[model samples]
Target: MSAESPPGLDLARLRSRLDADRPGLVTGPLSARLIEGGRSNLTYVVDDGARTWVVRRPPLGHVLPTAHDMVREHTVISALGSTAVPVPPTVLLCTDDAVLGAPFYVMDFVEGTPYRRRDQLDALGADRTRRIAEAMIDTLARLHAVDHTEVGLTDFGRPEGYLERQLRRWGKQLDASRSRDIPGIDTLRERLSARLPNSPAPTIVHGDYRLDNLLVDDTDRVTAVLDWEMSTLGDPLTDIALLVAYTEGEALGDEISSVATAPGFPPVRDLVARYTATSGRDTSAMGWYLGFAFFKLAVILEGIHFRHTQGKTVGEGFDRIGASVAPLVARGNATLEED
Candidate 1:
């Protein structure tokens, strides 16, 4: 075993642990590379010559409380493996930090493309792009339809007062990562707090549901939904509004995902209508949810910006994250005011 390894993963220790626990999973020495495009949790694609898997761990430093729980992520993904949410199959969950510096989990890697930019969708043609987007909406509807209790997720999260708790939670997350003043953020939060919309029946919500978080196969079907660090049992409408928010103003930011900006992507109203028609849930109050979605995204990017400033962030595109926060705040405020 060599002393050299990726920044966060020690290949020698990882191979040793996997051999001791999940024997024979790896046939050769482990090599890993930190996967890019993730702004919160650190993801690595590891291979052992014959096999490949994904490793998810927390960021290098400045980790906010309850933000990147490996057990929570592992549990939900494992639980949803039996459901129709299209999560990767769980291999093993290693809570022992002696292996990976921080808590991390391993899952078999699925084959698909996580389309991030508009150009990628452009190559797929308008009809294919429309189908992919529609498939994403339908997949989300299916996830919300799953019975959490039946799938051994009865205590995954508290559904009571979910919207209020989310508001408070993200607000505190923003405070935790505040390195510089983000103008209009406080006002946006206050406006969202003023009139909380009544949430429908709670379901398993992928807290950060967006196009790039999903992996699509060549046939225009959503093969898997990646990044479950923010998932829990909560208001399903939050997922819908978050998806809409991602597509709203992404054209202005270099690092922001612009998959929705591609031609033939369905508009917000069409997405909402498709979701409503599929899930039978009303989205009449999405105006406020959209505002909160922008607020949440702003806070997330601000946290990444803070991490980048502290030299705790890994991978590229982090330098451009801070510039995107103010625009999201402005959009959030405008959305709330319009509502």
Candidate 2:
């Protein structure tokens, strides 16, 4: 790629800053390509002659405070470099807004495909798909087993009442973003609050742990676990639950008639078993955690629906997402009852 600046970025200023940061560092003609998939952040693939890098910044227009803390994201990824987890190498973090009009971080871009749907998995073959899934689970188990204090993440999150704060925080977010009151949203929130599960010792939890967030190589190994924006110290079960929620009815155990054919992924029980074996943690309360995960994702999707109703969301899918919230809440309630 040439040293020319890519569209939507300030080339001259960025070049100047780069020159100042590392004298004689070669940055050839820069071409910016917007990467799709995420709705909350603006991600670009920038190539400068000899090397390619990824830039992550907040989306344009109004945004919530501390919503996209690039510094925090950069810090976490940088810290993970020494861990067993696979993470992209962070090159630079620019808190100075003058460069990109917002805080941004550049990291070495990893090459792999994100598994977003069943077709993608099928394309990779059943054996490869299963291997990738297992690798993902193992990677998450390793992350949760890491000692936060040893890795300089002890101060990353406030563990005291973390679950309570999350419940309140997301509840407030839903209230602020709701365009219309869907049936059962209030009841769901109330039930989630009342049935808060027993809190375990805090560990690093990836708030979103779905197939789409992972990059799998041809050999079915996880090249990288992307999107650490929602990562923090919290109940490790929270991470496991989110993984279960993403696979619920879609991949885990028996397929639900309401949903389509199973994605052929391992059952949640087996996943928990693997994690327990790897991390030496008890699996007794996994059901409650899975319920919590579904409930949280439902609230978040509802927020997207609210944005869609206000004509804020682009493209299709948002219209029907609001309808899934109730089912997710019911799933959560059912899990709690089972416990």
Candidate 3:
């Protein structure tokens, strides 16, 4: 494998490792380019003219404990390869920092587009957009239907008290990233702590499930579900609620993905209806889950905001990330209040 690699990726060492571990995979010298639009992990597209694959590694600096877990990401994706869920086939998981200065994993690069803007969806027209949205929901249903035990992920995560642990986990994440005041954040956290919703039968939760995280083909099929950084065995409703929260659009501001605002993208009620019909999971508690989703999103955005403040983040969209935190906090509080 060999091109002049990016700052975090050493193409030469990667080529060496691939040759040693997965012989004959690389046909020529390797070249790699960082794939943008990912905020936490560093993803790069590596090519040797004959084949293409993706490499995922943790961020450059200021990584919070347990975040950007390459092993967990690789494990879950590898386990799900034979399931109904669409995932890129993993090549190898390299824990030797000597290879990439961080633990990383390689997967076949599925060909598809990650539509991050409403304009991009608008170009697809209303009917196609609707089909894409339906496909996205259908994919989620299929994922939630998978039995963790059957896939050898029985120890992946503690499903009991999953919602409670998620709240605490993101709370600690927020504390670790504190740099400025965020309105209603503390209130939202406290209220969330005061009343935790009961979870349904556990499923493999896609910690961040939304349109942009998926790669869609020209036929509107979701070819692959990317970004398993926070995936676990947990309440499937949380996934549905988070997807609903994303479809709310602009909660993270225009700089971030707002593809749901695109015309013909189904409404929240329609989204929930589709999920209910497909997954058959009761969404009666979605109000509370939506609130939790907002809180989680706020903490996530605030973490990014903190990283941006410290110049630890890469890519173009981080400059405006800080400004988006307060609104997310407010939205979270409001959602909980309504709930």
lDDT agreement with native, every candidate: 0.91, 0.73, 0.89
Query: Each prediction's Cα RMSD?
Result: 1.5, 3.6, 1.3
The parts of candidate 1 lying over 4 Å away from their true place are: 1-4
- Tens digit of per-residue lDDT, candidate 3, span 267-316: 89999999999999899888889989988988887788788888887787
For model 1, how does the per-residue alpha-carbon lDDT over 1-339 read when each residue is reduced to its tens digit?
233588899888888888988998889877788888889998889898788999899999999988998999999999999888899999889988778889999999999999899999999999999999999999999999999999999999999999999999999999999988889999999999999988899999989888888899999888899899989999999999999988886865858788878899998899999999999998989999999999999999999999999999888888989999999999999998898
Q: Which ten residues in a row have the lowest lDDT in candidate 2?
A: 253-262
TM-scores for candidates 1 onward, in order: 0.97, 0.88, 0.98
Tens digits of per-residue lDDT for model 2, 1-339:
334554446667766776787666545756666675565566778777687788888756545444667888898898888998888999888989878888888889998887766666766666676677788889998888789898899889998898888888777767766666566667766777887777888898878877777777887788888888778888888887787787773533221111113255667677778888888877687876777677677766766666666765543355666667767777777777787
Ranking by lDDT: 1, 3, 2
Candidate 3 local Cα displacement, residue 118, angstroms: 0.8
Error of 2 at 289 (Å): 1.7
| Candidate 3 clashes between residue pairs 3 or more apart in a chain or in different chains | 1-29, 1-30, 2-29, 2-30, 3-30, 3-31
- CA-RMSD of model 3: 1.3
Number of clashing pairs per prediction, in order: 0, 7, 6
TM-score-superior candidate, 1 or 2: 1
